[model samples]
Target: MILFENVSKTYPGSHEALSNVSFHLHRGDMAFLTGHSGAGKSTLLKLIALIERTTRGQILIGGQNLAGVTKRKIPYFRRNIGIIFQDHRLLLDRTVFDNVALPLIIAGLDYREITRKVRAALDKVNLLNKEKQLPATLSTGEQQRVGIARAVVNKPPVLLADEPTGNLDPELSEEIMKMFEQFNQVGVTVLIASHDLELIKRMQHRTLVLGKGKLIAQFPEEDS
Candidate 1:
């Protein structure tokens, strides 16, 4: 569902974050993006979400060229993809229900629909019982699950997560990864950017490794 062709991203003073990167993520594919710090993993995700545009080449999602998308249409286009961050990014003042309802609220859905979708998403992350609690009251793993619920509340076809298990213990990390696996089983295209090599290897999914802005290797070469 995602295609990148000869993509590059450069910032001020010729600082190139990515150089000639290319990959294709077929529908229902789940892959891990592995790289060291400053290896451009986050930059690549931003390009897909349109938070940052590519400096060269093209990006296609579901057959639509992102280069042709206008600035005014970015919000609408982004609704097709769900993004999870390492920090969870929940609003401390809001209840779990409200946090997950944010996307639907912004989309102008009515209260009834938002309520239904929010509960369903929280259920997916096993947070339904915590819906009335504030984000600060939940444990780190629960907080991350809240973030996951919020991201998928809209039922976006593609999910992108960056260092999703960065703060959890191995058991919790495995739990979180299993949640992602469940999502993928139902056909949500999942791409996660994480540096947890051992965990990534354990999962045994396709992985793309980067070094100094280049795609240095793809694991289980048979997939290539």
Candidate 2:
């Protein structure tokens, strides 16, 4: 669950990236964040992930105030959230299995458990056979799936994606969205920031829109 109370984020030059944006995403809810470029979508996700701190107001995740989270506890806190990027962000040199296994490794799982989770994640993305391959050897869409696999390999409770389907074709984009749906059905809270209005409409989930630095609209499924 996520709750933002009058949250605002301003940069060093006093450029406010978010202005009094507030919203509540209940546990297991799936929503899309949409707006024009520079509309603070990424900033909002970063605030939740603690990549950046809020300039004002407060953020609560599963009842834990992020303001109280110390820098030393960031890594431990992140274990509850999974993030996926549009660029795939895979390691060029490592095998796919290794990349997906990184999070579990950091969490100190043993080799057998890591192997099992890595294989299961790859299977979820239909990339189990490609586990031994390097990132460069995969196609664009395949690479993105790899990123998704890596993000969910740890089975985090909340998932955040920034323009996840930006680089893929329409069919691939739909496939990626369905993957997120599958995760959500299993009770993973999903928040995706994307610009594809048509795709968002097709998904028919809750949508939150932003303009400039403010939350302009939030539509429930029936209203969307």
Candidate 3:
């Protein structure tokens, strides 16, 4: 559902985030973008999320060229993708339900449908009981789960997670991974940027490794 062709990113001075990177992700597939610090994983995600435009190359999402997408249309393009972050990025002053319901409200869904989808998403994350709680009131793991709920509440076609498990213990990290796996099973194209080698080794998904802004090796899954 996503393709990057001859992609490169260079900063104002001499910094390069990615260089001539090209890859394709098919719909319903799950993959990991693995690299150490400053490897441009987040840069790649930002490009997809349209937070940053590439200095070079073309990006296509389901055949629409992002290079030509208008600023006014950016929001429409983002509606089909969900993004999760390491920081949880929740608004502490807002209740959990409001935070998760933000997207639906923006999409102009009626209150009844909004209530239904938001609650269902919270239930999937096993946080339905804490719907009324503020983000500060939940534990770190629970707050992260709430972040996941907000991301997926819109039922987006693609999921982008930037170090979603970075702040949690191993057990809680695994729990979050399983939640992502559940969504991937139902056809959310999942791309996670993570450096957790131990957890990644256990998942056994296709991995694309990058370093110093260059393409390294994309290790295909066995039995492929």
> What is the C-alpha lDDT profile of model 2 across 1-224, one tens digit per residue?
99999999999986899999989999999999999999999999999999999999999999999999999999999988999999989999999999999999999999999999999999999999999999999999999999999999999999999999999999999999999999999999999999999999999999999999899998863321
TM-score (C-alpha) between model 2 and the true structure: 0.98
What is candidate 3's lDDT per residue for 1-224, written digit by digit as tens?
Answer: 88889999998797899999998889888888989989999999999999999999999987889998889999988988899999989989999999999989989999999999999999999999999999998999999999999999999999999999999999999999999999999999999999998899899888888898876878783242
Off by over 4 Å in 3: 221-224
Q: How many clashes (backbone atoms < 3 Å, residues ≥3 apart in a chain or on different chains) does model 1 have?
A: 0
Q: State each model's CA lDDT, in order.
A: 0.94, 0.95, 0.92
What TM-scores do the predictions have?
A: 0.97, 0.98, 0.97
Specify the highest-lDDT model's number: 2
The regions of model 2 sitting more than 4 angstroms off are: 221-224
Predicted structure 1, TM vs. truth: 0.97
Tens digits of per-residue lDDT for model 1, 1-224: 99989999998796899999988999999999999999999999999999999999899999999998899999999989999999999999999999999999999999999999999999999999999999999999999999999989998999999999999999999999999999999999999999999999999999999888988898766254
Winner by lDDT between candidate 3 and candidate 2? 2
lDDT for model 2, please: 0.95
- The C-alpha RMSD in Å for every predicted model, in order, reads 1.1, 1.7, 1.6
